[model samples]
Target: MSFTQKFYTADHHFGHALMLSETACARPFASTKEMDECLIDCWNSVVRKDDLVFHLGDFSMGLGDAARVESVFRRLNGRKRLVLGNHDYAKANVIHPTLAGLAWDAPPAAAMETIDEGERVYLSHYAARTWPGQHKGSFHFFGHSHGRLAPFGRSRDVGVDCPDTGYAPRTFKQLVSGMDLEPIVAEEAESFAP
Candidate 1:
């Protein structure tokens, strides 16, 4: 495989018991085990081993054991790169830095620019009103809101909890094709209205 395809997702929160609780994001899983299994299955089904996957942040939480965390990472498919989330600790980095590929701990709301499908994109754990290259047609992908927030301008939530994403990693083509940016534009315009 040429590994040309790329996917993006975030807020898996693996091993976090709260994720399955009614108080937290209201994830559909009945237990942590079910959530973990379903997330892994969904990821593996869509992402090949040779494909690139950008995990925006919050990969796992509540699994204090290093070995357990690493175990979960081992089962996920694709070439994983991480933009560290609030839940990702230093222990995670020490346990499997190489496995995470180009990992970095980005401060909340910081923007990292990259090109996808010949267009610029700003990757962050939180969405922003505007980012670098926004005037030049750059789009933003973020997690952390868990789909609680609406998309703004060219930005959209890529979190697993997003209703449209269905807890799976989404490709650039899927994003472009599936997202209706008209609503976002209207929302932005509404925000600026008096």
Candidate 2:
């Protein structure tokens, strides 16, 4: 399918009841059904049928079966590429068939590095302190933190729960504009380890 733009998002946690609890992401919605529909609407509101989306991870959970998961996946707009999360696994390290059958632009991966419009973008389901090209102007984005993890160096969480992402997919330009983008220097990283 043809695409006009690229967007990034993750951690929708559809059908996952724990996501509504205060100990979890504390989603304001009263129920998973409400959260799911709102997430789908938020995605479709900014994403178009021809837009490409890179979902970092945790797309769905507790949906019972593949058919149910597929039902939700079909409602969102865009051609999707997924970076597998801990929840996406079925067993023996295999992705669920329903996700595999979704006509993804490429095979779902645990991590990926791409050249986008002459810029390098690295993607994963979890954050990293330093990535390939951290000092060469490359950008690294990930999800899975649900906004709990703070931005570190050139990488940051792109999960929907993050305020910067605004509970929806975001473009590279929009994400980068809010980033410091300063090259990581040796001695710049600090650790509390004894």
Candidate 3:
């Protein structure tokens, strides 16, 4: 019996035609329909009702525009998952009738079982200084180098890089014990990978 789930990984580069907040979207839209309705009203105003949003990837940029960003992520609420990045390979044949769920970059033991069980740790858009020295246990949240959230002067880590707009979304025990983040088990996730 262990029901503790409040994970969030950001990088909602939604449709991405361009113009993503150069001082809050300075006239740069060839499409993406106003950054997909302001990232679906800023991730449904900080995502609550059934929280569990793990993006950590581009989500869209092609593939017939991913059916208008999978119809606004199927009217967002929660329970979404996708680690497929690199512009989501033009959506790879869009499909997301059930909220959201996608996984790619196989072979890290098949992407570590597509994460479940209250998620002790596993996230990726990329950040591999060898992935904490070749897979260990839990804790590995990542996002393409928009990085900036230091605190690993010596050891144990719970990596960071979550921001899409004015960072707010939280949970995962307030993001790993409220910002004291230090959980990388096993090979110490390769000294916090990247």
Candidate 4:
């Protein structure tokens, strides 16, 4: 099947050493270095320089220096866009400034809407139980849960930590093709049953 140029992912937590600890995010990496390297490799492997990437939120953690964070962001492929996460603030400035310096586009809101393949897609850092156009076949994508929450209705977690996505950014085609929406649709229908 043909795919859209847009790819989605979030919660990279780059430079965050806790992500590699067994007691923290419980990532399988033995060290933060390994985790960062692997994530960068996985990202560049699928995303091209020309591709557009929608990173829902939490791109990095523990890297407080804007210059260092900017450096890391520059190394990643694709035209980047961000929906700021809670961890994104450092010192007195938002991370968007650094990203903007590198040509990354940061939408002002925590949530935004876009059209893809004739479908409305809601992008947010946190998942919502009921979103605009939820009953109109619109899709909602979010991060922040890190794969802990189950997807409902037409919503899906786009976090890199989401097991279903193999810790990499996924294209629109891949997400739709891989999703089995029957259960979710049936549940929604049941909710409306008298």
Candidate 5:
């Protein structure tokens, strides 16, 4: 059986610690403390008590960093799920209470099964391309590009990253009917890398 429910996602970079400050490649964050503060603030601000959060990926710097962040996530009240990202690999890593479990380099299609049939919601750490044909009917919610996509219009689905950011979440009906997500797409990340 498939389940459908309201979902929210935050990339929760903990201030992007596992990354270099000025470059695109992966590296440790310069200010771990500051990043932790911002991450907590952002996550607390958006998540409600009953809200289901699908943590798209990149939850922490690595296995060593997991305990710190996991403690924070555990304290915050909500239903959670995780789709392991590239940055999550390491020892001493503890999984979140609601995590589906660790996923190394699996394709989103395999993960798609975790989502309910015909459920319009999605969440992820990075942007992904719209599936073609039958699979194209669902809406995809993801992060990773970090507030970089340019806004095209309201009707486009190609660019909208988060639901609360002004861009609307596309419904299953909209995608299948061939409605214009041009505005969504125009502002969306250039390509869905994974």
Candidate 6:
């Protein structure tokens, strides 16, 4: 609930007109421009300039070029990092594992591990079956499913497009509050299918 801590978010798909279409995210906006502006405002309203933000991916699309992407980041609040998503690639299926390490505080990684609030954390644009130390209480945060994916064990999706997040950047505690985090084998994970 506090805005002073680190935050996670993704699937902004800024400038991607299709993001608001019914077949896509079905965002409540008349145009992509309106959606983009609203998302930025929501992000800044919660995230402070010094807060760390992990953007799980699809940060930009349909913006046309790197400069536009860079410009968008400029208007955004917080010191940001990226976990590259599928649509975040340059030419080939390239937004995985690692990036050229430019613009961002570090390279845009497909996945990576870090420490958060004294707990181990795994970050990715896609969900993982069993992250390192999950049974030991580590948390895996991801995006790209746009809220369709089911959370397993301690994993969660931080995408803003997800109705749960309400287009705002949320702290890890805020993201997982009230959820069952007890250790469970990945084999017992819930399925989206009936």
Report how far off residue 81 is in candidate 6 (Å). Answer: 0.3
TM-score of 5: 0.53
Off by over 4 Å in 1: 90-111, 178-194
The TM-score obtained by model 4 is 0.84
Model 4 C-alpha lDDT versus the unseen true structure: 0.78
Candidate 6: lDDT over CA atoms?
0.80
For candidate 5, the 10 contiguous residues with the lowest summed lDDT are 151-160
Error of 5 at 18 (Å): 5.2
Tens digit per residue, CA lDDT, model 5, 119-159: 44444455555431213344554455644543222212221
Per-residue lDDT tens digits for candidate 6, residues 41-115, read 999999887788888988878545656666777899888888888888866866522234335777677787878
lDDT of all predictions, in order shown? 0.75, 0.84, 0.49, 0.78, 0.44, 0.80
TM-score on alpha carbons, each prediction: 0.81, 0.90, 0.28, 0.84, 0.53, 0.86
RMSD of each: 4.6, 2.5, 15.7, 3.8, 8.6, 4.2
Candidate 6 is scored at a TM of: 0.86
List where candidate 6 sits over 4 angstroms from the true fold.
1-4, 93-102, 185-194
lDDT of 3 by residue, 1-194 (tens): 23434445555566665535554334344456765676567667777556666666655554454456567667766666666556555245443322233322231111222354444454666655444422434455555554454423111222222332343345455554444344445565555557
TM-score top scorer: 2
Name the Cα RMSD for model 4: 3.8
Ranked by lDDT, the better of candidates 4 and 5 is: 4
Worst 10 residues of 6 by lDDT: 94-103
For candidate 1, lDDT tens digit of each residue in 88-161?
64463342343243233323223456688887888888887767766556788989988898877678889999
How many pairs of residues collide in model 2? 0
lDDT (tens digit, per residue) of candidate 4 on 7-82: 8999998888877776657999878668888888899989887888998888876554667777678889887888
What residue runs in model 5 are displaced by over 4 Å at the alpha carbon? 1-5, 15-20, 24-30, 91-110, 113-119, 122-126, 132-136, 149-194
Question: Of the candidates shown, which would achieve the greatest lDDT relative to the real structure?
Answer: 2
Candidate 4: which pairs clash?
none
